[model samples]
Target: MNALMLAVALATHATPVSLEDARARSRDNVQALTAALQASSAEQDVRASRSSLLPQVRFSAGASLNYIGPQRSYNVVPVEGGGFQQLQIDTPEVRYPFFNLGVTVSQLLYDRAVWARLEQSGAQLEALRGEATEQQDTSELEGINRFYSLFRTQATIQVLEANVRRSEQQLERARALFQAGRVGKAEELSALVNLGNDRIAVVSRQSQLATDQARLSTWLAMPGAEAVEAVDPGVLTQAPAPAPSLEQALQEARTRRPLLVALRQRLRVAELQESIANAGYLPRFSLDAGYQRTGPEPSVFFGQPARQNRVNGGLSISWDLFNGFSTQAQARRAEYQSRVAELNLQQSERELEGSVRQSLVALQAQIVSAELAEANRKAAADALVLAEERFNAGVSSTLEVRDAQLKLTQAELTLLENRINVEIARFTLMRAMGTLAPGEAK
Candidate 1:
């Protein structure tokens, strides 16, 4: 039956999508893309923070006009010649246009606050990366859910159509028996009613399938109008794996979940923030150097002999003595925020453990249900066959056959639903354990 269904599905779909394919396409989901952009922005922030520790270079040029008053001469008496003499000594030029060009470089030698901020930015970058992974995993899980929903609806439609065909045959048989005087008009009417109900069910399932297909298409970042066909994941045909212990699942979740990891990184960032606030009590050190050239004209600014060259270097230190208690307030705020982060981490861990337990229990129950549903389906099929034989032998009424057929159809749908539920539960468990991402071990 599985093989037949697979063959029919392949023949009908021009391109059927698999679970892995759906997960792969989830990278294009809006949330995933947004997370990626956020991570990229955080990376730039880290670079900006680190740049404060590196050398900064700048170039400057300017020109200005100058003015000075006229020079005055002094009269002096010579000791040997008893006569007054006017003495005019050489004087430096006082009126000139000035042109200056300079290059300056500055580097931070020591700054505790700057260093702490750099570390905080690095932690933020890591936290954002983990968040991006978490978003990608979430998107992939959503894609998986949509794929299975579409697959289940498609399979249910097939079962309903088959039931309709069976009803048609029953209707024909009843008509023949009535003409032969073996059965009354009531049997024919009942068979007709059954056929109508089956057709109605098929139509309902078809509508659901269309909705599911569109949902999957939109999630996979395809055109909204495009139809998506899902290939069966074949979970029913395979043997179920042993369930993991709740403790083991919790351990894995604690170590592997991106959300938890991101939270831990945020805690580190908060601690670094506290450090940065406390660093206000420490002095900062830096190095600065510059070379300048001045001339009376723009052309001579770059000339060798006409330019007055200057080279200077210095070390700087700055310490904040007081800021109206702002630093103390900031430190207190940072300490409280760090405590909040710690509390959040604790709460998240508890929630994660609860999720793991619930998922594991649900998965185990679904697996058992799938097994029982398969057995029920087989029994229903056998019962339907017996009822049809009895009806042909004239020992049973068409109503008996119709009831058996309905039971079989219902059993088939139940089995299909249980099988799909088992798969969904397993994926949910994997997600809880943070192993749902593509290429991760399940």
Candidate 2:
């Protein structure tokens, strides 16, 4: 199929579109913005993690009315008049109202676990950034592919339209010649058939172009995007150099894949988690201090009364010797998680190797295909010129000319396809090798 047919087949029923609009729409679309927000969320997570390590303070204050139930009787104090007589006692409820206020503060002291976790959070943040970048890369890559695809479809549509016009002109000439008795009924009939075939081809290609446009618009996230015209592929070109060496590409992937980096970050976090869990076995310490004043202190309604003042402070320590195996179970789970992270990192490395090899192989295939298409295109052009010359000289039939023309058009389309595919393959190789950035060129 010609480029337009390919595009139309790919698109929803629609007209053509311009390349610039498609890219612009994609950049401004929901997908791009969503990926950006995801990165920001990861950064916020890191900030929260860092904040966890900072000193925290809490204030406490409350007022209460207490109906002090019955005071304790004084132990035996002998009265001088009664000598050893039993002392009389009175028990009465005491009522008092007071307010208490204080502030408590705690600062992180020596916590190896905390330091490890902080570092882990930092790594995790970086990993998230990488993932967002990867997402952008995927979008951009798909955009490039769809963009060129649209170009091919537009080219094919042009070819089909031209062919239909040519066929109509041929049919008109044949009818005129027949009316003048310069051509036979067979010639007129053949021209009519050719015209019908060309019209059918034109209709099919047009339909296909519509489909390609719709698909492209959807990909660009421009739901309302209309038909756009594509520019002619001015000239064919090749990558500036042979594909980078396989070893070089593999190394790049090892360091570049966001998924791998994310796994590595998790591994670090798991190490930190394990450390934090182990810290449960160690003692923790805190300090508290306070001051208070009690007894009647010159109330607004009462004469000045004696008051008692007091101050107190203390250090506290805590340790958990054993749980019902809960802490131990948690520690074991963390260990298993750490192991999983390590395994993932290893798997990523292996896949990176395979990707590099596969990309190189695919790149080679495109190069060969492009070369073959180039040679075939030249041959088809020559054949087409010969067929047209023969027809104009009245030495060949219209059927022969049309067949040659079809072959020529098909060859050119194939060549166009090969060129675009080569570019796509190179782009893929760059991604596989990890050399391509995750975003548009700066």
Q: Which predicted model would earn the best lDDT?
A: 1
Off by over 4 Å in 1: 1-15, 63-97, 438-442
> Model 1 residue 216 lDDT?
92
Highest-scoring model, TM-score: 1
Q: After superposition, how far is residue 119 of candidate 1 from its true place, in Å?
A: 0.8
Residue 121 shift from truth in candidate 1, angstroms:
0.6
TM-score for each prediction? Answer: 0.88, 0.77
Model 2 regions lying over 4 Å from their true place: 1-32, 62-97, 172-182, 225-241, 287-315, 324-327, 438-442
Residue 122 lDDT, candidate 2, scale 0-100? 77
**How do the residues 21-45 of candidate 1 rate in per-residue lDDT, one tens digit apiece?**
9988986699999999999999999
Q: What residue pairs clash in candidate 1, if any at all?
A: none
Model 1's TM-score against the true structure: 0.88
